[model samples]
Target chain A: MAEGLVIVGGSYAALHMAQGARENGYGEAIRLISDEPWLPYQRPPLSKGFLAGKIERDALALKGEAFYRDNGIEVLLETRVSAIDRQARTVTTAAGANLRYDGLGLALGARPRLLKIAGADLDGVFYLRSLADTLALRERLARPLSIVVIGGGFIGLEVAASLATLGHRVSVVEALERLMARVLPPVLSDFMAQMHRGRGVEVRLSAGVQEIKGDGAGRVASVLCSDGSELAADIVVAGIGVVPETGLAAAAGLACRDGILVDDAARTADPAIVAAGDCVRYPSAFTPDPCRLESVQNASDQGRAAGAALAGKPQAYRAVPWFWSDQYECKLQMAGLSPGHDRLALRGAMAGGRFSLFYFRAGRLVAVDTVNRPGEHLLGRKLLAAGASLTPEQAADESFDLKALLAA
Target chain B: MVIYQLKDGSERRVDVPAGHSVMLGAVQNDLPGIDAECGGCCACGTCHVYVDPAHYGRLPAVEAMEDDLLSGVAAGRQATSRLSCQITMTPALDGLVVRMPERQG
Candidate 1:
């Protein structure tokens, strides 16, 4: 049995691999390391239910104490793996703890990128990523505060929705022309913008943050934008984007592109070393060239794949990517990876709220954004798994049931 | 074979196979109301069913996570509320009538 070190920033990938290793009879030491003080919890709900007071801190826990103890895995919290010495198969944590392992997994994940400005270092400036970040932001929710989210991506809009629901004035500024621009098309983005604005959230697109101004007390007071706008704010949250955690991997002589380069098996330059979750830029099942995914499905699926391979069940990871986000009254579910597409097949009705837009590349269905359409999303998941492509005309027709389309 | 009455007054009969989880039986036959989000791993706590008071000892011991997820539900959980995923269907479960809770957190 090989001892494994799953260096992780969060819990999802770490927990899954730990359990996988245990189930596969790897009785050796299975240790999980993270910078956070708490055990792993589901992060998808952090921006919605968890922030809205619907979910408590205990409810956010990934697994209870017994789950870890029963499986014979040791969890080390608030420990950051600063350096990785691949030749020695050892890792040095931030606190100077050198731990050796027979096999290693880099589920290090990514962090929210913050805007560099004067107010960025000031008080009341935030980024909603970890449970701690949510708890800190939740404390400000009850203070009758005004918020300015620096980006209109999923993170920003979700924060705006949560704040507005808590009866706070929220403004979202995005450098893109519309909201969710990275994942959705212009029309769908506009629809989401309308949805957010209708809920009384101030949504400003094409408005990049030039400088964040602070008050005399070192608190965020206002935001100065490229569009000649200055909005007053008691708090500022930077949800601009995220960069993959690849520094330790790079230092350890692992092949680093934009992310840790790996094959479909999620094996890096050293086959004994593997990377999963948001850190590894492994090959996509549908598209060409390797890519790094920051989504939960990518993390869990890749972790399971890598775990199985490490346990002598060697197989290439070829799973379709899927993710969902809950904002206000809508549950947006997307199946298949939503990028590298050429044409669109708009299904159902977007403005009415229940609709789906299919993203196709060279007449092959690559992705589908299903808003309140769980059936379409499920069918899309199956099709993408089978590499089954549907035509734009077939998907656009409301009479053609998604189930029938799948059978075709 | 077991017959259970739904909250809406509809009746659904399912074959409670031996050694299979009751939630697995309901899901395989599309009896509805059992949404096992974590795939019967007791992680998501979606397959919550309130067992009849008379049928408590018929199931296995309750695990920690299965008990924790039940605390978050809306309904008044009695001695029952077994995570259907955790219950392995046995010959003892024949003619068992466990009510499905209307909501899952």
Candidate 2:
């Protein structure tokens, strides 16, 4: 194993690689180069509790300095890796310092995609992807007024829910045919849309924002949709989604597609480098489809896996993916990938947001989305890992404890 | 009261009580930007901010989770890149300029 590991892009992947490199018995210098200039933090709450004001800022530290010092990891925050010299096995920073690395792991996570509307650049039309965005939104939230959020993805819906709880009039404009169309079932999305609307969020389906009009002062005030309707707002939140941050990788001549292309081993075109997090497209475990995910689980797992591999204990990244989001009082948890599913099996109380839906593909449980049911979600993760096939009867019966099925 | 410079070059004057993390202190006063998601347990790694290297020693010793989280954050974390939640305003960080990370995860 090399005596040093340098990981790039300080999000979940950067943190995991630093820790995993030490744990994997690589008695070497571990360094992380991050562009954000902050500690490795989790993003799940950016759209949930933190946005809702339930969680405070200091509570978000992933770890303190002791972990790095104890583990022999060097972290360079706020340093942007401007260029990766593939031939030299070195990275030059934005500040004009070049560092050599034996192995490199890129956790350069995805970024929120720019909103497709006029006046998106105007003040008050913000995206809910970063701490800064949430903090800025909170400034607008202080007055307890109306908020117009574009997109019905997880972030948008959660932001809508949080603003509604704060007594802000909320409206969500989703260009999608339905909410969470990529991850959720139609029925569940419908249920979720109802819940938000019930809380006074006017969710407009199939409504794409054609143009956003800021006030005379250059602050967002309303959105004009393709449907030729005007939606008023005190502020606009665009959770449209994200694109992988792979400019450095692509510039360095790495294979890039929807994400950096990697095998199960999380390796890029360069054997000396690897990629993880929402920025890489890798083989999926539950099915044949290659997937690129924006979930925290993927970022952490891929970072850890790539870190270990970079340490020469090369193993394919095949961990079951899981993620959780807090919307209002509802804790939505997902286990496995829900792609290519033929039907969804329901358990628990869906109406109250206390149930779960197990997605089955070819009679096998491929993925499960649970709301406020952690126990079932845990088992569902195991089920996905084990490729556990389940009968519909077993799924429909709430009396059928999922853990027991795991044992069987 | 302590004055801290945010990432955006704006100065935030936070009236922190005695013995509160600069991160939490800013948050308590309704500072618009710090989001500490783990309740300051040092887990979840969301409350990351870089302290001015010039004034790092004024802060408290970094704990285990704080270190762990920093390691994972984008490494520009300098001698000053601290989980702001881990920093207590000890009058030493009086004029500290803290910068926020672009994304928590």
Candidate 3:
């Protein structure tokens, strides 16, 4: 009931908004409301380290309990805000409690896009998103079983890699012709497919899930593909994609298009309202089009921007976007967005499993994808942030001193 | 507990559990200096800190990822400079002191 800043959701963006606001000298009661039972935690490791049991649950927490208490951040975990009244400047919780806020931040995040095929609702079919979902999936994976992972995006591939590493019979069914076709270039997609195949995972490209056949006891037994092929599967995990949680924002009459529209400062059309994280589509310095990014970098930076705006010192959120994925022995690190890059220049050998792909659009460095090349990836981020240009020839030459350009 | 020596010569002592990293100690306690932007993934070198020379030798060797990342840190690297996330606290190093860098990227 504190009449100050009220942030909705429990994730990176929400936590950062609270922290950023407090750090920016927002001396008021800040309340973070979330439907999740646990405090905000990192989602990146859920499919990799957490599923592989390399990372403990405690380590997944974004910040410790003492953080919220000491920072005067009132956390309302397991509480969902059902409605937002912009007129009254109050949020109505699912429990019928209305909390007033001088400013509101919507970090609604996103939800898994469930399969709409036949028998999709059967047991033994899961989606990985929250801690509860991961725990349930992990529990079901106690024994070795045939797992059919639908989709080949980051989540699906990470899950596929984890399950395959765990010695399970795994198959990746992708509707597209290549793995991670949307985000990765054709070459990297081929590399990913080859990598998965090398790790004993059956990579099924251009195979769409037609139906998930269920056992007589209501558990999934097999997955029927669009090619009329059937894969014997004891478990089905679909990571098709996610739909932004923009219903509340839209209902409250906020501008929304696939995601809630926000400015570079993470502020919505309404000056008193702000949005960040996966649920927001905002302007970016890297791209001409306003985009919505799902990486920890985007979430944290946008969250910080939202907090700064909430604290009355609004600055543009233009941090270079970067993402990382650890699969088996390969660490794929990508910096910048390469949506419309016309050319890709490779630096290093793919055979050696260490390389960097520089994506250029209209003769300008657009993005960089580096595999097992942490140094290149970090340099790419800096290069993009500085708006430094690199020629394809220079990028291809291994001996070219990339660090010298930072000084330029 | 872990002591974070701020760039301003101030010190922040926080009670971070043994299993957590030194970066977690500063972040969880709301210490201002360390950004830890990548959230301990060692992908971003923002959590760069200078370990006290006295306790620097006691810590484990820096891994390749951390080493590679340290090269890109904003404050520049030093012999005693280490990524706080790479340094997990232990009972043997209860009095470990890590000095925050001038800034993080």
Candidate 4:
């Protein structure tokens, strides 16, 4: 009998890999190893619905328990893989158990980049990554408390908005000059800042955290900033960003950079090993260089590609990247990559907080950002995936039917 | 319980609790053919389904956002086309029938 396929890690990437493998007819025994105590669950809602108490814990499950059992996917929860012995084709678990595999998958997702300043580890300072982190933060949010969210990225702004809506005093601090500067242009970033401010969140930009000060009981009391300003806080949440977990791959003698190096088929340098999701930087049609995307779309599509490879049917993954962020009553949807965009066109009324921004690079449609406009956003995904183009004038005109472009 | 009509002339009966969306039923059951990539947030249009004509009207009216999203599904839109995520399961909707598209965009 074959040793079967062994998948390491949990979350969308790992879960989808198992599903994809089974769906593609890889019938050998499948074992999924994860360090998380809980079954693989959705992480996006942790900051929004779950934090707001609108979505229950049971609803977070990606798939029901019976699904895994019925599919013959054995899930080993709370088991950490200490080392990978590529020569033996087995993984050593922390408990001294070695699991053998004919093929291996590295779905090791990213981890939260921690704050390194003094008092960073003090109680009341939290990072949102795992369900455990969110649950702890949720428990802390049971009572109204002053919160200084230390980032203006999507995660930070989202947590701030969720807490503010729950009637908590919230303040957002971003080291950048504008919110989400790394992704969105200044125009959208300004709109985000205004939206947070209108909802009673103090949006502070261009300020870096110097240190976190602890109280007499060793709990976070306030955050000291680089400009000598201090914000009182009963708790602090850092959403700086994430670092791809490439340690396992690197230790196993695989090529690793910012992420584990992988090909279009999510294959590493080793023929028997494949990687996907946030941990692997792979070639994409949308980017001039290999990039690692940390979105649900990337994880699911790339995991599917990895599964196909494991099933001996490797195909180049070409799924278009798309993402969404829900803050307050507004929904921000984005499609495609737009960092090199030289022009932008707007459709719909921005004054009412509902509009779409089209990004163009040298007269070619590259990406789009739609706020409260799901129609354009959805059309944008289809258009981008098809490599279709639109003139700036056509994209700006509200009367222009985007569906016609898709049909064409 | 819900009946999912597949493109291959097959059907899957899944027991989805009331208040959960129709997409969640297929996803949680590990049923193939329905890809709720965005986790039923209506962000991705992958979970497209064609409701059985007789039971179509029994579901809630499509909102503006969902209506706009329906036009862009990978499978060509049908008069009965609806994003499964937009349709919530109700006791009255028990044994509801929804057909998955040949492929999700």
Model 1 lDDT vs. the true structure?
0.76
TM-score each candidate.
Answer: 0.81, 0.79, 0.96, 0.95
Candidate 2 lDDT by residue in tens digits, A314-381:
77788888766667666677888886899888886776667889888877778888776654665677
Docking class of 1: incorrect
Which candidate leads the pack in lDDT?
A: 3
What is the fnat value (0 to 1) for candidate 2? 0.02
Task: Write candidate 3's Cα lDDT for B15-94 as tens digits.
Answer: 78888899888876768788877677677788899999998998999987778778888899999999998888888878
| TM-score of chain B in each prediction | 0.84, 0.79, 0.96, 0.96
Q: Give the per-residue lDDT of model 1 (tens digit) for A1-408.
A: 354555455567776666656656676777888888998886866788788886556545655576677777788888888898878878888889888888887888887786776567888889988888988888877777788988888888888888888888999989978788888888878888898889999988888888888888888899998877899999888888898888888888888887888888777878677778887798886668778887877887788776665565656888788777778877677777667789998988877788889899988888988776654665677677777757899889988766554467
Model 2 alpha-carbon drift over 4 Å, by segment: A1-3, B1-105
Best candidate, TM-score? 3
Which is the winner by lDDT between candidate 1 and candidate 4? 4
Off by over 4 Å in 3: B12-18, B90-94
Residues A13-106, candidate 3: write the lDDT tens digits. 9999998898799999999999999999889888998998877888888877888888899999899899999999999999999999999999
Error of 1 at A355 (Å): 1.0
Who is ahead in DockQ, 1 or 4? 4
| lDDT (10s digit) by residue, model 4, range A120-163 | 99999999988899999988877889999999998999999899
> Looking at model 1 chain A, which ten-residue stretch has the lowest summed lDDT?
A1-10
